[model samples]
Every structure is written in C-alpha cells, then in structure tokens.
Target: EDQVTQSPEALRLQEGESSSLNCSYTVSGLRGLFWYRQDPGKGPEFLFTLYSAGEEKEKERLKATLTKKESFLHITAPKPEDSATYLCAVQATTNAGKSTFGDGTTLTVKP
Candidate 1:
C-alpha cells in the first residue's frame, strides 16, 4: 500500500527557531513528491515538487527535498506568520492523479 506519514503531529517553536519536518512514505513506485503549506482555513498552497532522490527546492525560509523512501521540509528561522500545516504528498505511476497526502505536520511559531 502507498502511504505517507508525518512526524510530530504538532510543533511549537519560538520565532526564529529553526527546525526540520519529516515526511516518511511507502509506495509502489514514486512518480512525484509534492510539498504544500496550508493555513487555518485555506486549501494547501504548492511549495515544491521533487521527482527524484537528491533533488531539492527552496523558497524563502522553507526547503523541500525528496528521496526514494522519504522527504523532508526544513524551516529556517521561521516567523509567526510562517506557522501552518506542512503537508507531503506522493504520486505513483499506478496512482496517477491520485496523490496520497500525509496527515500533515502542524507548526506553530510563537512570536
């Protein structure tokens, strides 16, 4: 079965605290890895897409990288507004258009 799991369901970090979020996954074969950020009442916003191991994408203080078995979202010096749920999803050849999403890692940044 293809599945994705995120660690530390919730995280509380003081402003400027840097941390890395983990997304572990299991799939028949990975076609793409997606990273998204969601706020309190909005749908997820695309952040990055990783198609292969060793590939990475970055924007502002956020960085996403993917591997054969897992992916990571790293937050550096985060701010209050940066607080949100970080979601990881994966699409396999057999699961095309059906991206399985992790429960999500909720991050709270305290200013």
Candidate 2:
C-alpha cells in the first residue's frame, strides 16, 4: 500500500518568513506526486505535478520538488494572505489516477 505523510501538521509564520513543508511517502512504483493548496470550505487548488526525481515546479511564492521517496513544498517570504492548507498526494503506477493523500499541513502566516 502507498502512503503519504506530511510533517509539522501545522505551521505559523510571520510575514516575510520563509519555510518549507515536507511530504514523505512510500510506494511500490511512483507515477506522480501532486501538491495543492486548500482554503477552508474550498476544494484544493492545483499547485504542482512532479513526475521524476529532481523535477520541480513553482508558482509565485511556492516551489515544489520531488525526490525518490519524498517531496517538499517551499514557501518563500510568505504573506498573511498565503496561509492555507497544503495537500500532498501520490499516484502509483498501477493505480492510474487513484491517489493516496496526506492529511495536509496547515500554514498560517501572520502579519
């Protein structure tokens, strides 16, 4: 069975503070790693898709990188408005679009 675990569970950051959220996983064969951001009462918004080791993607203040067994989501100089729940999910080779997801790391940035 594939499983994903996100670290810190929750984080509090001051405006302009940079931090990284972790997503660790174990799978038989990795198909892809996905990252998303979700606000309360809303569905997750797509952030990145990592397909191979060392692959990375970025958007605004967020950057996501993938490795053989884990992924990281880095927040750079975050603002209060950047606060959200960051979700990590992984798809295995035999599961097609099916994915095992982490509970997510909730981030709060205070001004």
Candidate 3:
C-alpha cells in the first residue's frame, strides 16, 4: 500500500519568515510525487512534479524537493498571501491514475 504523511498539521509564520514543510511517504514503486497549494474552499493548485530522487522544482517563493522516501516544500520569506494548505501526493507504478494524498499542512503567514 502507498501512504503519505505530512507533518505539523498546521504552521504559523510571520511575514518574511522562511520555513520548510515535510511530506513523508512509502510506496511500492514511485512513479511521481506532487505538490499543491490550496486555498479555503478551493481545489488544490499544482505546484511541482518530481519523478526521481534528488529532483527539485521552484516557483516564486516556493521550492519543492524529492527524495527516495520523502519530499519537502520550502517557503522563502513568505507573505500573508502565501498562507494556504499545502498538499502532498504520490503516484505508484502499480496505480496508473490513482494517487495517495496526505491530509495537508495548513500554513498561516501573518504580517
């Protein structure tokens, strides 16, 4: 079975503070790992896709990294607008269209 776990269910950061969110997973065979940002009452927005260990992607103030067993979302000098729920998901080689998702980590960046 494929499984994902995100730490610090919720996070609070002051404007300009940088932090990293963790997503750990176990899968039969990794096909891909994904990261998303979701706002209240809205569907998640795609952030990054990583296909192999040591891979990484970046957008604006966010950076996503992948490892064999885990992934990280790094937020740099975040602003209030950066506050959102960050989700992690994984696709396994055995599951073509289905992905296992973590509950998500809600972030609050205050000015």
What is candidate 2's lDDT per residue for 1-111, written digit by digit as tens? 999999989999999999999999998899999999999999999889999999989999999999998999999999998999999999999988798999999999999
For model 2 the local lDDT of residue 68 reads: 96
Which residue pairs collide, candidate 2? Answer: none
Angstrom error of the Cα, residue 98, model 2: value is: 0.7
- Sort every candidate by lDDT, greatest first: 3, 2, 1
Candidate models: Cα lDDT each: 0.92, 0.95, 0.96
Alpha carbon deviation, residue 73, candidate 1 (Å): 0.4
Clashes of 2: 0
Task: List model 3 lDDT by residue over 19-100, tens digit each.
Answer: 9999999999999999999999999999899999999899999999989999999999999999999999999999879999
What lDDT score goes with residue 27 in model 1?
Answer: 89
What order do you get sorting by TM-score, best first?
A: 3, 2, 1
Output the worst ten-in-a-row residue range by lDDT, candidate 3. Answer: 87-96
Q: Which candidate achieves the best TM-score against the true structure?
A: 3
Q: Clash totals for all models, in order? A: 0, 0, 0
lDDT score for candidate 2 against the true structure: 0.95
Looking at candidate 3, what is the lDDT of residue 111?
100
